[model samples]
Target chain A: AQSVTQLDSQVPVFEEAPVELRCNYSSSVSVYLFWYVQYPNQGLQLLLKYLSGSTLVESINGFEAEFNKSQTSFHLRKPSVHISDTAEYFCAVSERNFNKFYFGSGTKLNVKP
Target chain B: DAGITQSPRHKVTETGTPVTLRCHQTENHRYMYWYRQDPGHGLRLIHYSYGVKDTDKGEVSDGYSVSRSKTEDFLLTLESATSSQTSVYFCAIRVLAGGLNTGELFFGEGSRLTVL
Candidate 1:
């Protein structure tokens, strides 16, 4: 079984500041990684995914995550963040050709003005 | 949008009472899942279904049961609701493109259940 670990429980950052949310997963032979975000009272939304890619994947909203095979990490980062970026972020992993995903506890990103 | 909807968006039930939550999808996805969200425990899978009449337990399936009798509907039941079961429940459908599972999940708005 695949498992994900998000060491940080909460992250606070000032607006326009860079931020990074760390995530690491149990190494697997065929891993597919994903990042999902949930705003207050909203359902989870896909931020980005890494599936047999160039090791780096990006979201339209300027969030990016790099799949580090050796380190077993897929840390999410944004060069600069807005107050709207405050949300709960989840890191998930699943095996190729499988639909079951193992999600990390989650990291709450709190962006302040 | 995957056209997913969860019934009883908010409900208040008593302990030991039976509670059922329904998830319906118009996308005809082959996979559906039930998850519960708590303050520190992110989202934990309770149950999932791969096809009609097929279901499986998840990480937190101890007190939950699920059934998928049709392609578009998946039901999750708490045989005997407990205070510990008071949480936000989410239903998700898997999107498999070209027969490849990218692990993309689309979630419903969520059903909030409070047990006293």
Candidate 2:
């Protein structure tokens, strides 16, 4: 079974400041990584995903994540964040065979104005 | 939008009562899943269906049961609701592209159940 670990439970940052959310997974086999964001009183929405390729994956909203095989980590980063980016972000991992997805505890990104 | 709808968006029930939550999808997707979201536990899968009548248990399936009779409908049932079962439940469908699972999911608004 694969397990996802998100180191931070809450991250507070000022608007326009850079932010990073850490995610790590435990799996020996190849896996897929994903980030989902949930706004207040709504379901989660897919932020971005890493299937394969250059190890660097990005989303349309200026957020990017790097898949580091050695560290078994996929950390999401954004050079500058907005107030709208304030949401609970969840990190998920799925095996290459496309079984089930395991989600982390989630990190609440609070962007203050 | 994926056109996924979960019934009884908010419900208040008592322990020992039978509860059923329905997930309806307009798209005829082959896979549907049920997950429960908690404060610190994130989301935990309860059950998933690959095809009609073909369902499998997930990590936290001890007290939950699911049935899929049609591709557009997936039902989750709790024989006897408990206080611990009070949580927001989400239904998701896997997005397939190029005859392969894209590893992406479209989730419903979620059904909030409160067992008092």
Specify the highest-lDDT model's number: 2
Each candidate: chain B TM-score: 0.96, 0.97
Q: In angstroms, how far off is B59's CA in candidate 2?
A: 0.8
Cα lDDT of model 1 by residue, A1-113, tens digit: 88889999999999999999999989657788999999988899999999885988989999999989889999999999999999999999888866578889999999999
Q: Write the per-residue lDDT of candidate 1 for residues B29-107, one digit (tens) a residue.
A: 9999999999878888999999999998899999898889899999999999999999999999999789776679999
C-alpha local distance difference test of each model = 0.92, 0.95
* Chain A only TM-scores, each candidate in turn: 0.97, 0.98
Clashing pairs in 1: none
Q: Which segments of candidate 2 are over 4 A away from where they belong?
A: none
User: On a 0 to 100 scale, what is the lDDT of residue A78 in model 1?
Assistant: 99
- lDDT string for model 2 (A68-101, tens) is 9999999999999999999999999998867699
Off by over 4 Å in 1: B98-100
Q: For this target, which candidate reaches the highest DockQ against the unseen true structure?
A: 2
TM-score of chain A of 2: 0.98
